[model samples]
Target: MPLLLLVCFTLLLPPSLTAQQRPTTDGPSDPPARNWYHQLGGSVGWARNGNNDFGPAVALGIGAYYHHLRQFGGLVAGAGMGFELMNADREERLASLTALAEYQLGKRALRPLLRLSGGVALPVGSPGQSLDSRRAGALLHPSVGLLLLPPSGQWGAMVLDLGYRFTRVDFAAADNRGGSFEREVSYRRLTLGIATRF
Candidate 1:
């Protein structure tokens, strides 16, 4: 019988080569490609408004931003625009436009943001009947910010913001004795800033 079938095929070839060198067939390989939850960053911010102790309380601006990366869990949404230069002593220049929505808790490396903003404020180089008696309208803001990216790279980012604005104006504070005309003027601000992203 061919020498008893060659001794049972040489005892099954050393247990099939030691089960093909076990150790789960040379391990290693279980999801790891760096996506850090879809990276995206861009921002710039600065603001301030100290009610009194002087005019032009505080104002300085520069803005441009975009951030959207979070399918669910640590959400994000953004929009921005700020151009302000309100230096009292009749040097008023203002332009602010913004829209934002955010929520992030990606934990660590400085990332904390919660914001809401509304915009509209224009007044530059007075004239034309003082721009209809110093017209200032449509300004509502809400904010909170701190977002600095680079936990895994993809683009650069940095944002620091604190905001609050409410302004309404209709000049001509007095005209009387025998004339007739009241007054109205209101402007407010509170902002702190820093932003950069690409």
Candidate 2:
């Protein structure tokens, strides 16, 4: 009976000793975790004005974004500005501002994303050359893309985006005899751009 008690005491004593000897210095605690990210990227795509007889037009844009990484996915928001040269003959310059939102799937190196954007577009230069009074109008964009995260400890990643954009502009023209006419221009764009995230 004494030997049995001695064996039981030995087994319990080791666990208590191990617990007492365990390190308690709290050495650094793994640096806490970061849950937010910032990204910047540029895009180039094509635009077509349905009212005009022009072929596919081209546009360029630059944007910055902020993302909150969550358990299910990431939420993204950002703003961008872009310019487009429309039609072959009109050669009109259009400037735009965009507000963006995105939902990203997966937390892996490569993830798929859906994006929506809306804002305004204005004529850059003298619309008087083509019309009398020109006004800026609303714009909308929706997109699907892929995001490629960098390897561990890297600074940048690649983004592939495909989207469609729509914009409208209103203008009025005056004739020589003090008669005026009003018209609207609608633009539809198919856009694709590659960007980097940091």
Candidate 3:
């Protein structure tokens, strides 16, 4: 019996020693916050008025965007300058500022993107002149588009956007009674750009 007890004690002591020597683990810790995607490039996009009374027109400008989540979807604000031609009756030189909200696909390295934007434009000249003018007001435009993510390892990042904007303007010449009425203008464009992660 004493021999058996000694043997049992010997076995138990090793286990105890091993237990004391082994390190304790606390599983995994929290992960860091996700990084944001940004883009800087030139775009020559088009616009189609909402009224359906007009066709697609072209606008040239440089655009830069940063993604954020808040009111509206994800907010995006940008500015562009270009020549705006209405029907055969009118055309104008203009500058625009815009803010938009977007819904992102997933948390993957490269995410699929969808966005909506609302912004205003300021007319530079009298209606269609490139010179200059003191007449300035606000024109509202809204748009929707798709953004493609670049491959993290070997994939490409592309931004393909199609959006429609609505705007209005009132000038003394546009209204016969010296009073101004709101004219509905539509805009549509396909913009391709690239994005990067920092």
Candidate 4:
């Protein structure tokens, strides 16, 4: 969709908005020099399966990332790995291990962040859904969010994110009497969290 492409551009593109500061006097001398660090974050949110099925559910996650404030000579970039846990409905509980990458555009305390994540997930618990009865599936998620940081020396930030998640998992009959089938689930996700640099 066109909307998806727009989000990607906003995340990966250079700063053009007047609000974000442009390097003054050139030569990277203006912006403060603390260019790299490690960050950790945790979030809690809601997820919706399909419009007609499992309308609402709970989702949670935690992550660790390596951040480069001056990536590519000044662009902000981050890469990490994390885990996500969710329940689409009463009968399905899933957990995923994902690789995450993000690019940000900002120079002020408030900035826009775009991220993409991919990995695999499996059912952790649920009636008729267990390690023995289910197969791990692929997971893909893309999100756009705002990262609000304090002044240059500050060590923490507040984040708000909105994104979409898609997954496919297969399950077989408990007794193997019926053939296996795949369940493709898509979700609209909204979360709030905090991040701290180390």
Candidate 5:
């Protein structure tokens, strides 16, 4: 009888100890510390116009950016300025200013992102001497990119962005013949650029 009692106690002892020993898995773990970041980058790409009068063009840009990380994604905002040079016989340049936003995919060292930006484009220098009319207009830009973060260092992260940009310009002027006309110019831009975050 004592042996039977001893065996029963031995079996119950393990379960009781296990019930007390097991750690609760439902509690959340502490999150890592968050940091604010700043980035600067430049881009070069091709630009095309809706009007056939101007041939293909090349564009150059520079920008500054800032963001904060969240659980799933982060909020990104920045400003950029750039110029587009058309292939027209005369010098035709367009200068631009933009505000940007991005939704970052994850908090990992490598993250994928989606971005949207909008701003205005102003005609820079002088309009081509041959042009009838030229004026500044609104711009829309969208892109997908990747962010590569440093493990834990002061060098900052690197970013690569691939996306499309669009802008429209309106014009009204009289030709040398004094015949007046109004027209609109549209630009479709394809661009890729890299930036570093600090």
Candidate 6:
């Protein structure tokens, strides 16, 4: 997250960028308040566990955000919370929530996007019988997507996101044979979502 913030500040603090990218009627994406917006979105994708299909993966998020200065690329940056869950056999498999820092760049509704989030994930339902303990897991997610915005009146737009979710996590536990194991695992997902601006 620090790395993403640094990139934001790098563009924010530069004197040279303060006058180059002003928005006009011809166009670009604005601001402090007029530039601020809120978004809510959900996604569907596939989840995998140990070389097998873990069934469907679902994700959701919501947040209010502000944009950088026009000179600083008028980029949108947001702070929000999101959840990802895995489901299989008509039951919940895993669930997690993570705090996020997000950024998107472009002059119009169709923009490229990137974000990062991290936190611990807990097994859902049966697997959660034991507490995660210190020997638990983490969800370090890095995502990239294309943001497709279509105007809806004046103050907002509809958000359509097509993206890839990179799921990074680890688990530690003792096997039935009295041996313990720790390994990093990943779930790759192709996700799409619809969001609204306010």
Error of 5 at 125 (Å): 2.7
Model 4 agreement with the true structure over 17-113: per-residue lDDT tens digits: 3224534432222234466656666655565434545554345433323333334432445555444455543355666666666666545445666
Best by lDDT: 2
Tens-digit lDDT track of model 1 for 64-181:
3333333234555444555554444444555555555566543433445665666566554333123324455676756566665443333455666566555554443223254434
The lDDT of each candidate is 0.46, 0.59, 0.40, 0.54, 0.59, 0.48
After the best TM-score superposition of candidate 2, give how far the Cα of residue 81 lies from its true spot, in angstroms: 2.3
Q: How big is the positional error of residue 62 in model 4, measured in Å on the Cα after superposition?
A: 11
Candidate 3 runs further than 4 Å off: 1-38, 41-89, 108-110, 126-144, 153-157, 171-198
Residues 55-142, model 6: lDDT tens digits: 5435332222222212224345545545545434423344555555557664444555565555655543345322232223565556
Residues 39-94, model 5: lDDT tens digits: 56666656643344466444433333333323333767766666666334434456
Model 2 regions more than 4 Å off: 1-40, 47-73, 126-132, 172-183
Once all C-alphas are superposed, what RMSD does model 1 give against the true structure? 22.6
Per-residue lDDT of 17-50 in model 2, one digit per residue for the tens? 3323434343211111344444555555565323
Clashes of 4: 0
Top candidate, metric TM-score? 2
- Which candidate, 1 or 4, would have the higher TM-score against the true structure? 4
Higher TM-score: candidate 2 or 5? Answer: 2
Clashing pairs in 2: none
Winner on lDDT between 1 and 4 is 4
- Global CA lDDT computed for model 3: 0.40
Model 3: per-residue Cα lDDT over 1-198, one tens digit each: 332443344344543232223343321111123333334334444444344336544453334444332322333333333334433334544455555555644333223455555556655444333332233445443333333333223333445444444444433234545554444333344444333322
Lowest lDDT block of 10, candidate 5 = 23-32
